[model samples]
Target: MALPYGFVKAKIVSTPQLKSTRRPHEVQYHLHFGITVNGAPWDIAVNVGTTDADDLLKYQLVFDFRHSVLTTLKSTSPGSTDLTGTDALPALDFLRSDFLAKTGAWRNSDVMDGSDQVEPVASLQRLLLRAQQSSLDVYVFGRFYSEGDGVHDVHMNQGSRGEFIHHAGDDSNDHNDIWQDGALLVDLGEPEWALYAAAFDQQYVPTDDLGNPAPGSQPIS
Candidate 1:
């Protein structure tokens, strides 16, 4: 399950801040960016992180979710999951946890040893830099707070259970399928724009949300 909106074609407006936080019942790394949509001020948390799992250093970069929209790649990923980008994609279109690991362009030499937090941050810095100057279409699930409103779940959001299943919230206003979520589309004008999708846990939410795990109990699986 994901936000009612599909994605926001956006531009990164400033230098983003990278941060790791242990807030409430979860741990996450957030890339906070300031953005403007049609000259209207808005912020984007171009985030990729984990929850309940210590594997924060591992992430995948899907270099072709929308690449087929421009070029002729025989196959964008493994199996029948052809990321040809033939039409406007919804977040639910990508729901596999192993989508990037199996299909995206990541080198074996790029693996980060599970020792510290440098791996994801280093890679993200480069990606954010690419996004700073290049035009980007941030595919997202919308989340709104009183102080702000922005797209979240900038990662994969399927293969989930319990309250984390995005459909658990706002039934009438959400995508009802079991598998669906968010991602990013980067345009380089090279006839091959790239898309990167990530996932943490669909069960993780704000302290007040209905799906959030109960206090002092186990976090969502």
Candidate 2:
């Protein structure tokens, strides 16, 4: 199916900024670009920061799809009443060690526990190893839409996730931005369903190794 109105030709416009600080340890920032179906500009921003022992960073992004009439229609009124549990899309999550293992970049060392919901430590180990070897750039894209039997049906999927590392002092723009580009198309299971377009960018610190800081080690700066 064709992508929603505003997202048809979306594009990513900037590189992310990475900052090493004593307060937060690590901070990353970036942005994305697109135009709504009505031709209004769509801009999204993301920020992420992390401390030493965490395998994940605190992440946040601003998404503005208000100009998307189709999204507004589907998210409100009689259209929303038709949705069912099955119509809800899966949640999009950050990449973790388990995901890396599944992708053949590493091996799983810990038993799978459903309650943890966090990525395995092995993945963080691999990521830190890579980071130490060279600066790494990672990108992620998220697309949300509706399809099948319900009008308010929602679905989410990742376009791609990958890493590119550069030598330590290369200064070749090692920083990475995750808000590349994305598109969404809602079928609403009917011809009358409106079309919406959404484009967003996310900037966040990469997950660090999951362990306590080394004794006497200073924070990043």
Candidate 3:
């Protein structure tokens, strides 16, 4: 089974940092942003596309994610909350829920044009910066650390394949689960909240209840 899937309701406390711990020829890049949950330091790790001239799997980005879950999230307490059981907290499911609209809504190309052609990193940074400037609370939907002070996998957690599919000796994808998708939502005040979501290029939509890709599954183009 996957780790405890949940969300962290907090406020941005510091500027975002672009960090990479991968070795040469490896493409593991993340945007590490800082937030304070109930006066404690917490990290938000968001995956981004690589600028390296490699043919690794690129990441897909989506902004302005809309869902009724935001209404419930706004009422949650400040700190880490486990959304594992049947509760009022709405769990995110990228393929099963209406978190996003049509397939074309996914942005995998240039987010900006001309001189302002910023990568996913810069675009996410600007979003966080705006939230910080507005002093809004950030609701991070993902798996909370079981041993540390942070939340990772803030992206689409379904339709996983290959190495991402956790093998439990019997080749079963233990990591696959419904209603545990990850995303980030910033409360931009009444009727206006900015959301940030991402997914790997290899991941496909129309996942099954087990979170596995169903027949005719297609990637967001």
- Where is the poorest 10-residue window by lDDT in model 3? 109-118
How would you order the candidates by TM-score, starting with the best? 3, 1, 2
Each prediction's TM-score against the native?
Answer: 0.59, 0.22, 0.80
| Residue-by-residue lDDT tens digits, candidate 2, 118-213 | 332233323323322442211222322333211110111111122222223332322221222222322222232211212112222242221112
Which portions of model 2 miss their true places by more than 4 Å? 1-9, 13-28, 31-37, 46-221
lDDT, candidate 1, residue 220? 24
Ranked by lDDT from best down, the candidates are 3, 1, 2
- Kindly report which residue stretches of model 1 are placed more than 4 angstroms away from their true locations once superposed: 51-58, 64-88, 96-102, 105-117, 134-147, 165-180, 201-221
Which scores higher on lDDT, 2 or 3?
Answer: 3
Give one digit per residue, the lDDT tens place, for model 3 in 92-200. 7766666665324556523222122357676778888888877888888887776678988787777777555543333233376677878888887787777777776
* lDDT at residue 63 of model 1 (Cα atoms): 53
How far does residue 94 in candidate 1 sit from its true spot (Å)? 1.6
| Model 1 lDDT per residue over 21-125, tens place | 675756666677766655666666655554545433224565544433323222232111222122233323442223333455322112232223454556666
Tell me how far the alpha carbon of residue 144 in candidate 2 is from the true structure, in angstroms, after superposition: 10
- Top candidate by TM-score: 3
